[model samples]
Target: MPTGVALREVRAQLFGAADRVLRRDGPSGLTSRAVTAEAGCAKGVLHRHFADFDAFLAEFVLDRVERMDEQAATLRESAGTGTVADNLTDALIAVFGSVAVAIVALVTFRDELRARLRETWPAGVPVLTEAVVMIKDYLDAERGLNRVSGDPEGLAPTLIGSAHLLFADRTGTPPDRAAVHAMVTTVLGGQA
Candidate 1:
């Protein structure tokens, strides 16, 4: 790119580039240089916007988490309208559809990124943590409607952890949707 050309939506463009790097190359391949290269922007563009790579990564995770909040709202609205297992299952698929799993791996390997995230999150991985809370909140809504019975607090982590495992690694494809549905059903079978 040019030295003086303005980059519109620079953060988003860089974030999209980083996400692709994380997905394609995994954490090992994700670096400021790679991201800038992938983004077709000068390396200085990234440094100019964010203090460091870790700061950019933390902001990226925060942006994704903010997006997850939209999905959470949608899921909560779905509490009484569908089979509990299916609703939960579909939500899992959506949340795990791409970035969350890779983000977990990235956070695990990057000590500085984790530390920066902890300043605000102070508890868990951003997407995963939001996922757990999303599930728990949805389950709570279902319980209130008597559509589901059991402890949402106890079940949320169980469900999210299981779902996370299903999406974590790949065999060229995500776990079969039916299999995931079955897993959710079995978990909630006693409750519903």
Candidate 2:
């Protein structure tokens, strides 16, 4: 909007605006105009950076997925350091307490967006699938270190699914940390 000043981190700013739009208005409310308005820029700001709206969306989802990779690495490193349930509890909070839930809903509601994502993400929802991978990999690491038992591959989906249900359908504010911890502890079946 400034006459001469250039915007730094334009992609981040747009992506963040889109995410807020998605969260406040859901998938239907996420549009180029909405995103641009939220970013305090002109509509061309989005098209200028992306081939189309779907392109911007795909990049937005991918950017969040990349964040999950970092979270996965940090989680794997925490293996054997804390109680298994506690670590999982924290990780679940990190995953859902962010924008993963909203992103999942967006992917579910948009057909073209889902199709566009399938080029790289062939199966499962984008943000949710990536979160599942993050949890599963960390669980496998914990299992390797003898910090956890049973099938992590099986447990990971259940944890993600259950947590998804818990985190989804909220009015305002995320589920309490104690509630998430309780769910994790329950899913672990005394493994914690």
lDDT of 1 by residue, 1-192 (tens): 556667799999999999899989988899999999899888999999999889999999899898897899999999899688889889999988868888999999999999999999989899998899999999999999988888899889988999888888842589888978977877786555
Error of 2 at 128 (Å): 1.3
Position 149, candidate 1: lDDT: 83
Model 1: what TM-score?
0.95
Q: Which 10-residue span in candidate 1 carries the lowest summed lDDT?
A: 164-173
- The C-alpha stretches of model 2 lying farther than 4 A from their native spots are 1-5
**lDDT of all predictions:** 0.89, 0.87
Q: Tell how far residue 180 is off in model 1, in angstroms.
A: 1.0
Q: Candidate 2 at 36: error in angstroms?
A: 0.5
Candidate 2 residue-wise lDDT, 1-192, digit = tens: 533336689999999898789878888788998998888887877788899999899999999898888788888898989798888989998888888888888888889889999998899998888888888898898889887797888889999999999899845668888999899888888887
Per-candidate TM vs. native?
Answer: 0.95, 0.94
The best candidate by lDDT is 1
**Worst ten in a row by lDDT for model 2:** 1-10
